[model samples]
Target: MLDLAYDLPAPKVIRGALHDWELVIGLEVHAQVSSKAKLFSGASTRFGAEPNSNVAFVDAGMPGMLPVINEGCVALAVKTGLGLKAQINLRSAFDRKNYFYPDLPQGYQISQLYHPIVGEGEVIVDMAPGVARRVRIERIHLEQDAGKSIHDMDPHMSFVDLNRTGVALMEIVSRPDIRGPEEAAAYVGKLRQILRYLGTCDGNMQNGNMRADVNVSVCRPGDYEKYQESQDFRHLGTRCEIKNMNSMRFIQQAIDVEARRQIAILEDGGSVVQETRLYDPDKGETRSMRSKEEAHDYRYFPDPDLLPLEIEQGFVDEIAASLPELPDEKKARFVTEFGLTEYDASVLTADVTNAAYFEEVARGRDGKLAANWVINELFGRLKKDDRAITDSPVSAGQLGKIVGLISSDAISGKIGKDLFEIVYTEGGDPEEIVEARGMKQVTDTSAIEAAVDEIIAANPAQVEKAKQNPKLAGWFVGQVMKATGGKANPKAVNEIVAAKLG
Candidate 1:
């Protein structure tokens, strides 16, 4: 029932020599499963370890070693499938995808082919306000990751790091529904966010923990509409694949360049070749890696060593029950329950840690005030210091306490900010910082009035101007604030200033 009418841009028709060209894109996103052990071995799945230090005999594929499926990895996979709203295949099996790579210790990689763990899902990617495109998910399969190939170790020699070998990965395959490069990147991002929320993946792109393979092709404009109506893929053009994109910016660039390249080739009375391509970030163009390989080329077959995976409905239900609130649902709750604006809620709930911190600060306190401070003041300072919420100088408890003081008029906004600085820098109770620095609000009406009178007398011309133009009353407010040494409650100061001006 989620409205997707606003999410997609109107399709633009393309005219090429053969037909009006439409780009058909699918994606295969690889997300490393969050687990301490490798998929088939007890070897540590730690990153940045010394080369081969974390490898076990099984990971190295020594003689007489048998593969064992990690139960934790399976659980994580189910959690991910549920998060994607995918159908969990209770009887998924593993197959060997035969391939040759310097880093693959095993001659054949174990992957899901015949039956995948997840099936038929959809991701709603919001590109702009009131506009979202639903990218259909074909399948998500669990597989063992191969080791990394480091070609830069030496000019002549390529070194293989087996530490990452047999690490579990969730290969999420999307249908060819994405129309443009930006949509592809957005789809990947939303997938990453969902996986992270499900606790299945860390969603880290830099450490090779996550990556996307973009499949792009172009056909005539009306062709896509025809394909949508009939569900015929041939209605679109033959697509080529771009492999292992880690950066979002590069993803967009790759799609744009590839689309244009295909368009130009067809325009020049040439045919577009279906191939695996690599994006050169420096040159901002895609170069051919090799001719696209069909599924038969991999020689996929059932693995003789491992048995098919099966799980009980109870297990899946348990994972679902334990799931945390997802980003979209949490954003909505932040707006409804916390009385926060949609923008504020979205910003706070972008990350789990930030959302948790905000919730803790909002508990039993003014939601709007806590949201304002967290988003504007605290988050702004965190950005300036390049610190994450987990590493914040001020704890959620401390922030809540500080806001409480401000709410009760125990401290003026200026004094509260000063106290916040002291607490952030010195690491102490908010009340103690206020007490030690004499940073309480001047709530006494008599004291505030006397300060206001002095300010009005000193700024007589400004007061005269204020009497004529009510908008100019802010000038007197500023004077009163300055006269009271910024200790007077800002709300009370405004009222006193207005009365004096009148």
Candidate 2:
């Protein structure tokens, strides 16, 4: 529902020797479906196993070996589509995309072309705090992945690893709504986050679990607006596809470099070539791979082995009902229910584990106090040790107990932090830790007042100066804290100090 086109000014279209241009982009993100088995085979879909160790006869394309559909894979694809709020097709069919590659042992890929599993979805990507952009999803189809071809180990021969072969992929196509590189990166990140939350894809680019092909085109400014208005794309100019971008940072960098490359060519009175390009991170540039392929190039046709996939509406409704509270909803609830700042809620909900941990620590306690301890003290310590929230030494229950003690005035803030260290390292109940360490607050008003009176008597000259300047009275409170070994309640010290000074 978020509009990306809002606040974006339409660029002026110019027809000149050196005319300014607009860059229009769309993305085809291939996310490996998170299932234990491959799409059409029983081969284990594990990463970094001994080469070909995870392959089956069907994955290796052994003669007469037939392909069988993996229902778990279908469920994942459907879940991902639901996460994007896309229309789920009750009936869809797979087809054979015939191609020839040394790594593609089947010589044909089983893919969905004619009827995809999902149709027409939209993604709302938050670019910054208040800015959101919507990118339209054209379709999401399932396809089997090809194997890996290793050419580096030998000069005269290439080796193929079919371990990755027949693995499931969801090709989520986006309309060319992106106008800049930063927005493109943001769109991919938001998609990854949603898929992860859905438990449909691991969304790990480093492990080759997800990748994107960015289609970029440059036109005279305002041509993009005209295309939006009239649905005429001829005015948008030739498009180049950047293939297999694996990193978010590299995606943005590739776009910037590719746009400038096209701009330089057009400025020199040369037209930009429409081709498939690859990005070289070392050189920070994109080079042409080949002319981009059309749908007919692959010779798509309905597969003979697999039938059309269909499910009842009740199944789809079940998935919708079981959906977890996602990131955006959790963030809003944290801000509204817990009284947290937008920034604080965002930080806590960015990761599911962190949000769950925060909820546990905040249970039945002061929300702001729990958030302060978790975000400031706990997260700071975890970062120093290079650990995640799940790896924290202090459990959520222990943290909640610590917050309770602070709220009940059983310990001062300083003593609470000391208790945290004890519980974090020594591993014991907070009350027991405070008792053993004598870290309980000096809540006895008589004891606190004695320390405050002693400090005031020792600094009569300072007390006289305090009467002249009320702000200077805080100096006496600090002195009382030092006199009591930091065990005096800060509020009690302040009250006693103020009374004596007056």
The top-ranked prediction according to lDDT is 2
Give Cα distance to truth, residue 217, candidate 1, Å: 1.1
lDDT of each candidate versus the true structure: 0.86, 0.87
Weakest 10 consecutive residues of candidate 2 by summed lDDT: 1-10
In lDDT terms, how accurate is model 2? 0.87
lDDT by residue (tens digit), candidate 1, 391-417 = 999999999999999889998777778
Question: lDDT by residue for model 2 over 126-235, one digit each (tens)?
Answer: 76665667789999999999999999999999898888999999999999888788889888988987888888898999988999999987887667778989988787
Model 1: CA > 4 A from native: 1-21, 458-462
Total clashes in model 2, counting residue pairs 3 or more apart in sequence or in different chains: 2
Q: How well does candidate 1 match the true structure, expressed as C-alpha RMSD?
A: 2.2
